[model samples]
Target: MSLRDRLFGRERRSAQTARKRLQLVLIHDRAGLSPGTLDALKDDLVAAISRHVDIDASGVHVTLRSDRDKQRLVADIPLAPSRERRRELG
Candidate 1:
């Protein structure tokens, strides 16, 4: 860490992360969904998607986004490469 970083408490990255989490909480509250409900929704999404395709469940991200007057549910699901694709890449 540089002297400037230490003096400025450059740990702002962690603070930003916390702020994002707080924003998510607010969004969920506004949308009338609890955190547990969100988790259950994510699990259901994983199960439904996994039935048809391979996915990296651990890396899946499901969140709510507020845009103008709309609250949108966004899901970023990472797909695992198929065996043929893996072999080709390897």
Candidate 2:
């Protein structure tokens, strides 16, 4: 990251990774989707998101997480700054 991005707190790598993990854990803990379905969902999600913005393909992380009685789906999509991607490569 550039010094400027760091100083501006543009999401440290560790924090971003943890957030993605936590979100996935929450959803899996609650919904209990099968592995195959989950994988398909993640792929579809990446495809959908890519249509709107440029993303780091290798860095995409999608998961479900749970906390107590709450659960949510988390997708960590590292974006390419100021770029819009027309479509995602499947």
Q: Highest TM-score, which number?
A: 1
lDDT of 2 by residue, 12-74 (tens): 788789988777665665697855778898889888888987778778887666668766677
TM-score of 1: 0.73
Global local distance difference test of model 1: 0.91
lDDT per model vs. reference? 0.91, 0.75
By summed lDDT, which 10 consecutive residues of candidate 1 come out lowest? 6-15
Q: At residue 18, give the lDDT of candidate 2.
A: 95
Q: Deviation in angstroms for 79 in model 1? A: 0.4
Summed backbone clashes in each candidate are 0, 12
lDDT of 1 by residue, 1-90 (tens): 678997998756677889998987889999998878989999999999999999999999988889988999899999998999999999
Clashes of 1: 0
* Candidate 1 lDDT score at position 51: 100
